[model samples]
Target: MGRNRISGVIPSSLGNLQMLNDIDLSRNALVGSIPTSFANFGYLFSMDLSNNELNGSIPKEILNLPSLSTFFILYNNFLSRPLPQEVRFLEWVGTIDLSGNHLSGNISMSIGMCKSLEKLLKANNMFSGPIPDTLVEVKGLETLDLSSNELSDSIPPEIRNLNAL
Candidate 1:
């Protein structure tokens, strides 16, 4: 469900839907961290939990889902802490949006391992440190928005090599 007035935490029992391919729970009043049981979704391709009251760091298992190739959107939530390094496992994911949250720490260098990533939106958070040069490895990246954060240092000159940007 999306754009609803639904409130409260997402039920962890939802994870039992092993055949699920897509789930949209955006624009709700849901609170609490993402249920780790969600890792059980073997066929999940897209998930949108954005604009909610959810908090806590993302579960690494969610990022490691091999079938999660379409997109994963968790923006505009209260989620915090460094993005899990397991993000490197999303080798076939096309887009990832973690913007408008309280997430902090250096953007993981492992992000470059997302070989099929095309759009990575991580603006308006508390992330700090220099933009990782490894980002250049995402040669298909076309929309990378790391703005409105505490990032420092100069833009990596190597980023110019991303012909898709």
Candidate 2:
């Protein structure tokens, strides 16, 4: 449903597409939580769930996907706590966009482990705490954004290492 004006929950039944490797539901008017059924998309390698009215927690199971990449969960009304501990492995991912939500709590140090991260856009949220020194561990991090939040701390020395950004 790319660029469709469809609003409301993505049918939980979409999870039944077990062989689907790519799903693009971006730029839609969808709302509510991403169904837990979505974790059933085991073969999904690329998913674009960005630019919607979706809310609720980021499912932990989605992070465990072995071949998944290109996650886009941006520009929505997501009201939730910090992402799960397991999502840190999303470092194996590319182009994750989780901007414009109401998520709070410390930005996980585990995110530093996502060495494959690029196009990382997380701004306009309630995320607080210091920039973790561990963030330097994400080697290919090209776009590190932590803007417009309540984040308070001295900039970590490790950030200086990202001169490439």
Q: Return the TM-score for each candidate structure.
A: 0.98, 0.91
In candidate 1, how many Å is residue 67 off?
Answer: 0.6
Error of 2 at 114 (Å): 0.8
**RMSD in order of candidates:** 0.7, 1.5
Estimate every model's Cα lDDT from 0 to 1: 0.95, 0.78
Which TM-score value belongs to model 2? 0.91
- Top of the candidates by lDDT: 1
Tens-digit lDDT string for candidate 1 (1-165): 999999999999999999999999999999999999899999999999999999999999888788999999999999999998999998999999999999999999999999999999999999999999999999999999999999999999999999999
Q: Candidate 1, which segments miss by more than 4 Å at Cα?
A: none
> Model 2 misses residue 157 by how many Å?
0.5
Worst 10 residues of 1 by lDDT: 57-66
Q: What's the C-alpha lDDT at position 48 in model 1? A: 96
Once superposed on the true structure, which residue ranges of model 2 sit more than 4 Å away at CA? none
